[model samples]
Each structure stands twice: as C-alpha cells, then as structure tokens.
Target: MAIENRNICSLYDDEKENLLLLHSAELLENISQSKEKYRKIIQAGMAQWVKGLQEGRIKLDTVADLKLLIELDIQLQKDEEI
Candidate 1:
C-alpha cells in the first residue's frame, strides 16, 4: 500500500519501526546466524562444483558462470574466519 503524501504520521511511524528493528539484538543475531548458514551452503556448492570439474562433468571452457559463484564465495569467505 502506498503511503499518502499528506500523511506525515504514516512515514514517521514506519521510520520509528525501522529504527527499533535496527537496535534489536535478536534481529541482529538472527541476521548473523542466517549469513553463516548461507555461507556454508555456498561452500558446499563450491565443493560439488570442484567434484564436477574433476570428473569431467563440467567443462573448463564452460566456467563463466562458475566465476560468479567463486566471486561470491570469496566475498563471503572474507567475512568468515573459520
């Protein structure tokens, strides 16, 4: 639903709710946990991708899309210590 241009209160209320969530510890922790889970999933995918490459299921010349997965894995690994 669109907020009415004349309804300043609606905008103010939405901003206040966003600020509350920003300061919520539960929300922050949940976000951190979700990121770690997603990182693990991507790592698993990378492992399988390597297996495919070794078994000749994946082609060396058809690695353009794999480059994107590698980039994302690298970016996430930069944040993950273990």
Candidate 2:
C-alpha cells in the first residue's frame, strides 16, 4: 500500500496556525542549539590556533591572513548581537 500525504489545507485555520507555530518553535530551538554548538567549536579551534602560534607549532607569515582572521572574529562577534 502506498502512503498518502494529508493536505494541510484541509485543516481549519486555527489548527493550521497552531501547527505552524509549533513547527516554528521547534525550528527556532534547533537553530539556537546548533549556533551554540558551532560557537563552542569555533572558540576551541581559535584557542588551539593561538596556542600553536605561541608554542611555535604554527607560523603565520602574512599580514593578510592575520587580517582575515581578525575580520572573521569581528563578524562572529556581530552575529552574537543578533
């Protein structure tokens, strides 16, 4: 037997609105958690990068690369404001 998809339009307006609200809340929660996870990962990676630089394990020779990293960090900071 083939599974059939139900038409959302068949739902009453209030029911549709409730469903949409529930879905939106779930999506927002997922987005929030994902952002937090990525933020922690980025922070850890940055700490390791800095440690490597300090310990002479990594060498950055170009001003452009350093500038780019600085710009990216700045953008991440701005994102936190939202």
Candidate 3:
C-alpha cells in the first residue's frame, strides 16, 4: 500500500475577487494620501522659484529650459581664473 498527500495553496474565485477589491481600496487610499504630499512639495517649489526670480538668479522667459541654465552655469564656472 502507498499513501500520497498533496497541499493546495490557492485562493478560490470568490476569495480572489475579494482580494482584488481590497487591493484596489488600498491603492486608492495611497493615492489620496500622496495628493496632499504632492501639494506641499509643489508649494515649496513655487516659493523657491519666486525667490530665484527676485534675486535675478533664474531667467525663465528668455531661456527655454534647465539645459540652458546648466550650460550657462558650467561656462561661467569654467571662465574663472582657477
């Protein structure tokens, strides 16, 4: 005589559906929490932008984007006597 044993570890169809719903709720909650965090980050960034503008450290309209800023800074640094 021989004895065989097997173990199954799978969610049934209904259980899988319930898990999906729970996962979706968790994701939504995460996004909702992150929204406020993103808003604070944006606010801080805007303040920095305004300060840069006041100091004439950042010229926005003339330069298209960050690439120009980086290039110009590099050139200025290279022009130093050092």
Best by TM-score: 2
Model 3: weakest 10-residue lDDT segment is: 73-82
Candidates in order have lDDT scores of 0.77, 0.74, 0.62
State the lDDT of candidate 3 residue by residue for 2-73, as single tens digits.
Answer: 754332236577777888899999987786566556555555655666687789998877344444445544
Question: Which stretch of 10 consecutive residues in model 2 shows the poorest summed lDDT?
Answer: 62-71
State every prediction's TM-score relative to the real structure. 0.59, 0.67, 0.48
Off by over 4 Å in 2: 1-9, 62-82
- 17-37, model 1: which lDDT tens digit per residue? 876877796876787798788
Displacement of residue 59 (Cα, Å) in model 1 is: 0.3
- Model 1 worst lDDT run, 10 consecutive residues: 2-11
Clashing pairs in 2: none
Q: What are the RMSDs of all candidates, in order?
A: 8.1, 5.1, 14.6
Residue 45 lDDT in candidate 2:
65
Residue pairs clashing, model 3? none
Candidate 1 local lDDT, residue 10:
51
Question: Could you arrange the candidates by lDDT from highest to lowest?
Answer: 1, 2, 3
- For residues 15-78, write the lDDT of model 2, one tens digit per residue: 8999999999998788768767766766666777788789988788744554555566667668
